[model samples]
Every structure is written in structure tokens, then in C-alpha cells.
Target: MPSYTCSTCEREFSHCASLQNHVKVHDNAVVDRALQKISEER
Candidate 1:
């Protein structure tokens, strides 16, 4: 079986769909941090 890996966090998943879903968590975290930074700048 092939493994899928997350580029940002280097986490591994057995299925492509699982890896894709995991990537969204990273995306959300990035957006959250951006919002926090913007709020702090004000």
C-alpha cells in the first residue's frame, strides 16, 4: 500500500482522502494565525 504525507507537518496517512482532509486543518490554523496577527496589530 502507498502512503500519503502532509508536506507542512510531515504527518503520514494511509489514504489520499485522509491526507487531503488533514491538510485542511493546517489551512485553518494558518488562517487563524493570520487573523490573530491582524487583531494584534490594531
Candidate 2:
């Protein structure tokens, strides 16, 4: 799994999919957006 760092929540996730679900907490829009952006690029 790849390492993903979410600055919005200051937590690291093992993968982008996990990070996407985690962003639901604290409504971390930045992290969610980052994940989406990365996904779109890929």
C-alpha cells in the first residue's frame, strides 16, 4: 500500500481509498480534495 499524508487532519493513511473514507471525519475537505485530484490525474 502507498503512504498518503493528509495535511487537513495531520494523519497518515495507508492508501488513498482509506484516506477518502477517513476524510468524512472532521469534514477534512482538503484531504478529500487531494485524493480526488490524485485520482483524476491517474
Best by lDDT: 1
The global C-alpha lDDT for each of the candidates, from Candidate 1 onward, is: 0.97, 0.81
The TM-score, computed over Cα atoms with residue i paired to residue i, of candidate 1 is: 0.95
Tens digit of per-residue lDDT, candidate 1, span 1-42: 999999998999999999999999999999999999999999
Regions of model 1 farther than 4 Å from truth = none
Q: Which has the greatest TM-score?
A: 1
How close to the true structure is residue 10 of candidate 2, measured as C-alpha lDDT? 80
User: What is candidate 2's lDDT per residue for 1-42, written digit by digit as tens?
Assistant: 579877676899988988788877757666788899999999
